[model samples]
Target: MLPADGSGPTLAIRAVAAADLAALLDSLPPAAATFARASGFEAAAGSHLVVPEASGGIGSVLFGLGKGSDAASPFLIGKLSTLLPAGDYRFESGVADETLAALAWALGAYRFRRYKRGGEGGDGPVARLKLGPTVDRARLESQIAAITGVRDLVNTPANDLGPAELAAAAAEMAGSAGASFRVLAGDDLAAGFPLIQAVGQGSDRAPRLIDLVWGDPDHPKVTLVGKGVCFDTGGLDIKPDTNMLLMKKDMGGAANVLGLARMIVDARLPVRLRVLIPAVENAISGRAFRPSDVFPSRKGLTVEIGNTDAEGRLVLADALALADEEAPDLIVDMATLTGAARVALGPDVPPFYTDDDGFAAELAAASAAVHDPLWRLPLWMPYAPMLESKIADTNNIGSGGFAGSIIAALFLKKFVERARTWVHLDIYAWNPSPKPGRPDGGEAQGIRALFAAIEKRYAGA
Candidate 1:
C-alpha cells in the first residue's frame, strides 16, 4: 500500500481574480513568465507564474482551476498531474475546497503499474500540498483508502487475481478488522452452492463462496452480495477478442463490495455486516456449464441456463438466496451483470433497482451528496414474466435482449424475498475515459451512495 500521508505545503488557493493578474505576472521570474505566456497562463484550468529565487531556483507556483459554477461540481485539480513537472506542487488559486483538491491530488498521483515492464520511476517525490484549514482529515483518509482499493484490485490481471486470490484479499481485510471469514470450496460448494459450483467447475482453480461477518450480531443485519467472476470468457457464448481484452475487470462488483465493506467496518456503522461473494472464473473448458443446462441453487430453485454468458446472475442468485435466508434488514447486491445497463447508463454511472421506497430515497440522497453517481430504475413488475421457464423456475436470460438489465434484476429479485429491503446495482465498473478523481479502468461505482445510505439509516439508533 502506498503511504497515503496527508501532508503538503501551504498553497494560496483562490478563484482567479482579474485584478490580481498583473501582480501575479510581476511576481514571476523572466523564464517562468515567458513559459507562462507561451502556455496561455491566464487561462482558466491552467496554471501560471513560478516565483523564483535570485539564484534561479524555483520557489512557489501559481495555478488556475476556474470559478465554481455549480456547488456540487468538483473544481478538479487532477489536471495538474499531467501539466506539472515531477517536483512537489500545489494549487495557488481556485475554489479552496481542500478535501476535494486533496482527493484529486491523490487520484492524479495514481499510476496503474501492474502490467508495465518497469516499476514506477524510482521513488519520485510526491507533489504535496497542505490541505486548507477546512480539511476533514478522517473523511479524506477514508475515501482515499476506498478508492485506492478499487484501483489496485481492478488494475491487476485475472491471472493474478483469480478466485483464490480474491478470497485471500477479503480474508486479509477480515483479519485486520476482527471479522470472521468463511470460505466454502470444492465438495462443500458443490453441495451447498450448486450454481456457483456449476459456473466455476470448468476452471482448474476451484469455485468458492466468500462469507465475511462483522459488527455485533444484536445489531440490525445488513448483507452485501457481489458477483465475483474473476474473468468472463462469456463461457460457451464466447465474447470477441476486443470484448475480452479488459475482462480482468469483470470482478469489479466483488471489488466494490469489498471497498464498501472497508468503509462500513472502518467507520463502525451501527449494523451487523455480512458480505457474500461467489468467486469464480467463467473460463472455456470441456466441462464448462453449457447453455440449456439447469442447475439447483442454494434457494432450491432450478434455473435453466438460457445463455452461458449470463452466468453472473446464476452465481448471484445462490448468494442472494443465502443472504435472504438470514432475513437481514437489508440485502444489496452489486454486479457487472448486464450490457443493457451499460447501454442505458453508459460507463461512468450505474443503475440501481429496489422495491423499497424508503431505501430508494436514501440511496438517491446519498448519490447526490457523495457524488458517487447512481440512478434508480423501476422493478417494473410487468417484466417479471420474461424470466419464466417451462421446465424450471426461471431462465437466466430472457427471450430477447430488450430490457436485459431489468430482467436480470428481476431474476435475482426472485431469489431474495425474505429480506426487509433488497436493492441491486447493475454497474459497469470501468471508466471509459479518465476524469478528475476517477481514472480509467476498474473503478468502484456505488459504494459512496451505499455507505451514506447505511450510515444515515443506522446512525444514533
Candidate 2:
C-alpha cells in the first residue's frame, strides 16, 4: 500500500511539542541543526520541517503537535501523507501510540480519485509510510478499508450512487463477508414498507429495503438502520440551490452503517449483526408524495407529511420499525435528519439521543477515548407533543421551529417500541471544510465511537 517511489531516501518522523522545540533542535546532529536553521524551521504548533542528513540527502520530518494530540486523534499526523517527500518514512523512536499514528497515516493517504484524473495529486512525489514493528498492521488496514468504504460511498455522485447502486454496494460488502443479504423492492416495498415506497416513488428507480445479517443466530442481536436518501431534492418541498448542493451525501448514514458493520464483522464481534437500509431518492415528480399526505408505516403509525422535505425520517422510520420488531439487544439508527443538529453540534460533532443512561455513558466514554466526539441530547417528553398531527397519528415534522432535532428524534422514537435500547443519531454527515484526516466532503461521524462502545459491551461474550 506504500504509494511512494522506492528509489527515494526514507526519513524518520519526530513529533515535537511546542515547549520541547529548543531541546529537540539541540539534540539533533550538527548537520541536521544547520539544515533546520538554514531552512527557517520554526517549531510552532501545527508546524513541520524537513532536516537534511550529513550525506547531503533528506533526513527526517519534525512535526509540532502543540500539546501532544491524544492517541485517539489520528489526525495530528494526517497532514504528512501529502506534505512529505515521495518516499517511505517511519517514526524516529518507538511510539507509545503507534497504532493510532499508523491509522492516521493510512487515513491521511486517502484520495477520492474516481472522477479526478491523475489520481490524488501531490506537490512533489506522493509520500509513503514504512510500517514499524510497533504498528498494528491488521487494525490499521481494517480501519482504512472501512473508512475508505464510507468516504467513497458518500463521495460518489447521486447519479452513480442511486438507491439501486447503494443496495448493490451493500450486497457486495455482505457477499465479501459471507453474510446473508436480502432486498425488498417495488411491490414488496409498497406492501411491507409503505413509507419507504412513498418517499422513493418520486424517483425513476425503485426504492428498496436492503437487509444484511451476519454472525451466529445465538449471539446477542445488534441491529443498525440507516437513512439512504441518495439525492434529497426536498420532494415536492424543493430546496434552494445552496441547500441542495451536497444532497448526494444524504445517504452518508447508510454508508457509515456499512462501514461500522465491516469493522464488526472483520473483528468477529460476538453480537449478531443486522443492517437495514431504506435506500431511496426524495426526488421531484408528478407522483411525488406531497405535504399533508398521511401514510401508514411499517409500525402501523399513520404519519402525516408536515413537509415533504422531512422525508429522511419517513424512510428511517420504516427501517427502524422493522429493526425494533426483532427486539435487538441494541438498535442504532443514523440519518442526515435535520439541520438543527448541525446548528447545535456543528458538523464535527453529532448529537445522539437515547433514554438509556448506561448506553449513553458507554458511548460518551468511547467517543472521548477515540476522539470521535458525540454529544447526548434528550428526547424531552414535553416537546414530544410538537409532532402531533390534526388528522394522522403524528406529523413527520414538528410545527414549531424550536427543538427541531429533538422533535425529529421524537418522531422516530414512536416507531420503535420493542427494542430494549434504541439510540437515534441526527447526523450532518458533510464536512464543510478540510481538516487533518477528514477531507472537505462526506464524513463518517460517530461510527468509530459507536463501534468502540459496542465492542466494549460485547467483547468477551
Cα RMSD (Å) per model?
3.3, 2.5
Listed in order, each prediction's TM-score against the native is 0.90, 0.95
Kindly report which residue pairs in candidate 1 clash with one another. 8-129, 8-130, 9-130, 14-93, 14-94
Please, what's the RMSD in Å of model 1? Answer: 3.3
* Model 1 regions more than 4 Å off: 1-11, 15-39, 46-60, 66-72, 86-93, 117-123
lDDT of 1 by residue, 73-141 (tens): 452555555544445454555554666667777776677875666775624565455555577767777
Per-residue error (Å), model 2, residue 393: 0.7
Cα displacement (angstroms), candidate 2, residue 284, comes to 1.0
The regions of model 2 sitting more than 4 angstroms off are 1-9, 67-74, 93-96, 119-125
- For candidate 2, the lDDT comes to 0.86
lDDT of each: 0.81, 0.86
- Give the per-residue lDDT digits (tens) of candidate 2, residues 1-461: 35333445568899876667678888989888777778776655557887777776788888867654432255777777877867778877424476777777777777788886666553446677877666656766777888889989999999999999999999999999999999999888899999999999988988999999999999999999999999999989999999999999999999999999999998889989999999999989898999999999999999999899999999998999899887899999989999999889788889999989999999999998877889999999999888999999999988769999999999999988888899998888777887877777877888889999999999942
Q: Assess candidate 1 and give its TM-score to the true structure.
A: 0.90
